[model samples]
Target: MAQTISVAGLRKNYGDVRAVDGVSFEVDQGEFFGILGPNGAGKTTTLEIIEGLREADEGTVAVLGLPPWPRNSRLLPRIGVQLQASSFFERLTAREQLQTFGSLYGVPAKKADAMIETVGLTDKADVRVEKLSGGQAQRLSIACALVHDPELVFLDEPTAALDPQARRNLWDLLREINTAGRTIVLTTHYMDEAEILCDRVAIMDRGKILRLGPPASLVRGLDAPTRVSVASGVLAEDEAKDLPGADEVSDDDVSLTISTRDPSAVVAALSARDALDGVQIRGATLEDVFLDLTGREYRA
Candidate 1:
């Protein structure tokens, strides 16, 4: 497929700090691409540069064949944006707020009503924005962004601060949007959300991408071995060391960590000995891979 978004050698600096340094990537048309990182990792900075909100110090950025910066008014109407912090006239009804945003994009009032329905806010359409819950407000924001029938959407932390049910609802909504052939570019810190919603993800830190691929492939590429933990009383150091395929066994009085490529082999070996008790094998997840890659350092 043709590229929907492209960036090369993207760099941005904020005085002493290089907010985005030497970043490059491409997002294919109709693909759900995500930028995953902790706060202050430059995910937002990069998004803003590509959204035409901020100018980059160096690099090229193209969205739907148009330069994102310099305000491509013609192209702006074809794209939708849901900012991390979206605000509106608190007193205006949800439907009214959407109508106003739609007018900004030159969309008709009828289209705005349709958008409100599309986001499942029809029952609450007449409710004032201030009365809407956080999730309701977020859904309204998404509906407003889509009111113009944009081919591409940029959602920044769309599910942040939402309840679990609300997050799940938004995830389903995003999947529906993507299934309808729209390209989505989102930035989020939630690993589980990225793993579930994104087709491909770029893990970024300190203004640079550390890894980029499908979440499953990225997790599979991790070198960390699967770990099996047992209650400290279940096994002694020598007993754990003797388990098949076990490596780097470490135990205290309460628990043990046993690294092994073949968790099944260890399980089978333990099962044969009838020594299994409180054993738990866990496959490595994206969270584990992320911590392994980025370390536990504080990023302010």
Candidate 2:
């Protein structure tokens, strides 16, 4: 794939606070790349610099092989950005909103209808923005961002506050968009979203990129302990710990949690138990990797 965006040793500081420090990564064409991090992790700052909204203090930055900062008007027309919260003319219809935004980039205003349809907002195309539901409005915001059909799209927390079903719907739409060849750079704290949508992810904290790779690989690479939970009917924590491959065990009156990498052995050992209710087994996940690397959980 062609390189769509590139940054080397990128740094941005506000007074003494290093919002983005020594960050570097490359986004390939048509790749769904994600930046995963907690609040104040500089994900937004790095995105802003790459989107040409802010200048980096140091480092080389490029988008489509051109400088994205210094107000590159030529590049602006080729990039789309959906900020954390996109504002629209409250009274304007969805289609009209896209028309206005497209006009800003000198693109054909008629494409607004096409974009509205692309984002699944065709049913609400003529409805006032304020009258739309949260999900509908968010889709409209994306429609406006994509009105120009830009090659590179930057999305900051696209589904931040949406309910589960709405978030899933947006995820499907985004996957469709990416499959159609748009390079998407997303910044979100949702591990599941990143794992499902991103071809590659960069876990960030303290204004730096801590780890970068495919989601499954990052989790597997961390070598996080596997866990098996059992509802204790008569077996005690001591017996559970003494089972084969049981590395660490914790117990309560109702359940036992065994943390280990070799779950097969543990499961085999538990087969002889007569009082066990059932077993729930799970492997390490992106959350585990995040915690292991950063020593903290991802907080939105």
Candidate 3:
């Protein structure tokens, strides 16, 4: 696939803080790319730079083969963006708001109504902005973003405050957009959302990317193997070590963490000694990879 967005050695700073430092990545045409990070990890800064909202101190960025900074006039018409938080005229109805945004993008009012329907907000078209629920408001924001029928869309925490069902609804909407050949670039703190929506993700922290790959590939890269937990009995850590392929044993609250690639072998060994009171094996997940890479330290 052709590259729709490219960043090379991107850098940005605010006073003494380097919000984004030498970040580089690419979003292919029609692909869903995600930036995953903790709060204040520069995900938003990096995204803003690409969206032409902020300037980069160093490096280059190309959105649709045009420079992203200084508000590329030609590129602006081809891209859509939904900000993290959106506000509207309190008295304006949903249809009126869409019309206003559509006018700004040179889209016809007729086109705006179509977009309203696209976002499933037609029933609320005449309702005032202040009367809409959080999810309804979010849908309106998305509709405004799509009013221009952009080839690429930037969604910043689109599901942040939505209920579970609302989030799932938005996910389906996004999938429909992607299926129509619109590439999506999103920044999200939700791990499950990234795992489900993103084709590939870059994990960022302290203004740097620690890892980047498909979610499944990154999980597999951990190479930690499946873990089997069993209630602690008379088994010592050393005794558990006797089990084949048991790399480490950790105990807490009468439970043991038996790390081994071969769960069957470990289970058979425990069964042979009649020590298997309770055992459960599970594969690693994206959360485990995040914890292992970033450590358990709380980042403020």
Candidate 4:
């Protein structure tokens, strides 16, 4: 597939702080790509540069074979951007907001109103922006970005403020859009969201990419031990430690967890001992890979 967005040696600085440091990546046409990072990790900065919202101090960015800086008018009609913070025209109803945004791209008012249904805000279509809940406002902002039917969409922490149900609903909506051939670039703090939605993800920290690959591939490459947990009191800690293939064991009252490279052996031993109650065998996940790369230290 052809590249929809490309960045080479991208750099951005905010006075003494380097917000983005030599970032380079590509998003292919119709692909769902994710940028994962903690706060101050440069995900938003890199996104802004590619969306033509901010200028990069160094390196190049091409959106659909055109430069993104200088506010490329040609690119504007072909791309949609949903910022991390939802912003809308003051006092406009949800339907009216969509209609107004769609008008800028020559979309009809009726078509725009229909998009309100797309984001599951049909009942709230008449509600003012400020009156809507955080999730509803988020849905409206997403609808506005998508009202133009742009081929490429940029979503910056699109579900940050949403409840679990709302987040899953938006995830379904995004999957539908991507399935319909729209390329999507997403920046998110949720590891599970990135793992579920992205075809490939770039994990960034301290203004640099620490790892980049498909979520499953990255997790498999970690070679981390699998963890098997069962209800506490299944066996004494000493007995658990002596279980076949157990590399490490710990009990936290609620559950007894055994970490082992040979999960099959450990599970078989647990089965033999009839200690399989509440058993949960878990392998390495994207979050594990993320923590391994970025460390557990909180980022501000």
Among the numbered candidates, top TM-score falls to 4
Q: How close is candidate 3 to the true structure, as a TM-score?
A: 0.87
Q: Count the backbone clashes (under 3 Å) in each candidate.
A: 0, 0, 0, 0
lDDT of 3 by residue, 1-300 (tens): 899999999989999999999899999998999998888889999999999999999999999999988988898889999999997876999999999999998889999999888888889999999999888999999888899899999999999989999999989998888999999998997888888988999999889999999999999998868888888874677899888878878888678879888888988898887777777788888888877877778877
Residue pairs in candidate 4 whose N, alpha carbon or C atoms collide under 3 angstroms: none
lDDT of 4 at 73: 97
* Tens-digit lDDT string for candidate 1 (143-187): 988989999999999999999999999998999999999999999
Better of 1 and 3 by lDDT: 1
Error of 1 at 16 (Å): 1.5
Over 4 Å off, model 2 = 252-254, 274-277, 297-300
Cand. 2 Cα-lDDT:
0.88
Judge candidate 4 against the unseen true structure and give its global Cα lDDT, from 0 to 1: 0.93
Report the error of model 2 at residue 61, Å: 0.3
- Which sections of candidate 3 miss by over 4 Å? 228-259, 266-281
Q: Is candidate 1 or candidate 4 better by TM-score?
A: 4
